[model samples]
Target: MNKKEYLEKLESELGQMSYKDVKDIMDDIGEHFDEGVAHGKTEEDIAAGLGSPEELAKSFREGGTVASVLQKKQAPVQNARQKDTTASAIFVILFNLFVAIPLWIAIVCAIFTVGAIEIGLIAGLVGLVLAIPGFGNFLAAGICLAITIALAVVFVAVLIILVTKYFVIGTGKYISWNKKIWKEGL
Candidate 1:
């Protein structure tokens, strides 16, 4: 194939990709052609070196998602679902399958710890409420319960923050997988 036909085929094969990606690939190929011509390389020789457009296109498509990592601008993550319920359900099912066990364990541990603290707080609160007048001091109990409640709130908040951070990471991975699966199926 001639250089023009080769580049056109490459561009057409890559038409479904983002314009920037296609443009970038074309630019690189254009550079290669120019450099080869400058160095007394024939169109046939350059085309041979580049291989068939279909094969080159297949390589590009099969390659890792380069555009996913490279960008001068980051798009805001839109939470609105453009896909139907089945795909959404599948994503959820896969998500749970991948992370449910460890996620549940962490949550259960946090809940149990919080439950223990709540039990202690309730006991102290009950003691404060039921204390006989002039028999003993309720001041210590109230203060302790207040402090424990505050601490428990902070502890639960920390757990939530940690869990949320990891969940977002897992979600990003799931989205990537879903995109790959969709592309492959197409």
Candidate 2:
């Protein structure tokens, strides 16, 4: 049979084997066929030399079982440590993305709050200058200035809170915790 037909037969017979494992074994068998062809063996001769697919699959399963057992025995301690490190790393990354990024964004928004106030102040000053001869104009400018100053103060406060929470609390505590976990694992 051709390679495709042979692979299909193997897949049907190997009930629990992964497709990748079956494919790898098929590749090895294909290589043997190629070698036989190079040595002037006919397709029939090559087919006769290669064992049955069912038998080959049993061998593959046996090998897989032995390998799995060996793998578990060889690295139980390392595997436990690797699992801990992986969990810690994931926590650190998630904390940075959710907590740190949002905190930093809040701080940036706070800084921009001052800029918004400055813009408002400039606008108010322009209005004041235009209203030079009118009491109404002065009153309007004063209101604008008050509103701007309030916004600036609120923004400054928000920025301070965000910076303190991220740098002083979240980062300081979690980063050190992550480092300690990594060192202990190593």
Candidate with top TM-score is 1
Query: Candidate 1 on 39-156: residue-level lDDT in tens?
Result: 9999879999988888888888768656665542344322223344446667656666788656766866876676677667666656755653434576676666667766765676
* lDDT, candidate 1, at 36: 97
- Quickly count the clashes in candidate 1: 0
Query: Model 1: what TM-score?
Result: 0.34
lDDT of 2 at 104: 69
- Of candidate 2, the 10-residue stretch with the lowest lDDT total is 128-137
Task: Give one digit per residue, the lDDT tens place, for model 2 in 1-186.
Answer: 655566567677777878788778778878877888899887566766666767766776787787888888889878888888888777767776898679767866775776566567666656655564566657776667656756765676676567556755765685687687655542
Task: Give RMSD to native, each candidate.
Answer: 17.0, 14.8
Q: Model 2 Cα displacement at 83 (Å)? A: 3.1
